[model samples]
Target: MSHKEALPKAAFQYGVKMADGRKTRRTGVGKRDDKAKLDRELQKINQIIARRKAEAADGGGVGTPDYKRPRY
Candidate 1:
């Protein structure tokens, strides 16, 4: 076969091999669990952001220093 014809055949075979590998890599339950964990982490991050915004609105957050008081 000519080089032009051989290259397409090799690429097609490689694509099929990769497709099969992806199918067997993860099961349905594992994918769902991963999604659930990611969702929980996202929710936690959003809650923290909201809390910080609320604190900032209320005249600065927890670690604001009092300028009127002397240091040490």
Candidate 2:
């Protein structure tokens, strides 16, 4: 509640781009889907999954989100 602690806290991020592509951050997509794009997306997903798995194997698993928790 204090400004001191609140200042360090970041507000809710709306469109944050993670390791995944734009689909992971926002919905909808533009035209242009070909063999190259499909292969590119598959590669991206594979990379993300592999990275996450490696992180988990290293004793650092992904945190669980509390659905019941209120959003600011």
Model 1 lDDT, residue 60, Cα: 59
CA-lDDT, candidates in order: 0.72, 0.56
Q: Across residues 1-72, which tens digit of lDDT does each residue of candidate 1 receive?
A: 556544587879878987877555445888899999999999999988887677668865346577742332
In the range 14-55, model 2's lDDT, one tens digit per residue, is 233343354553434433456669889899999888876775
Model 1: weakest 10-residue lDDT segment is: 63-72
Global CA lDDT computed for model 1: 0.72
Local error of candidate 2 at residue 55 (angstroms): 0.5
In TM-score terms, candidate 1 sits at 0.48
TM-score quality measure for candidate 2: 0.39
- Among residues 3 or more apart in sequence or in different chains, the pairs in candidate 1 whose N, CA or C atoms overlap within 3 Å are none
Please provide TM-scores, in order, for all candidate models, with all chains considered together.
Answer: 0.48, 0.39
| Candidate 2 wrongly placed segments (more than 4 Å) | 1-33, 61-72
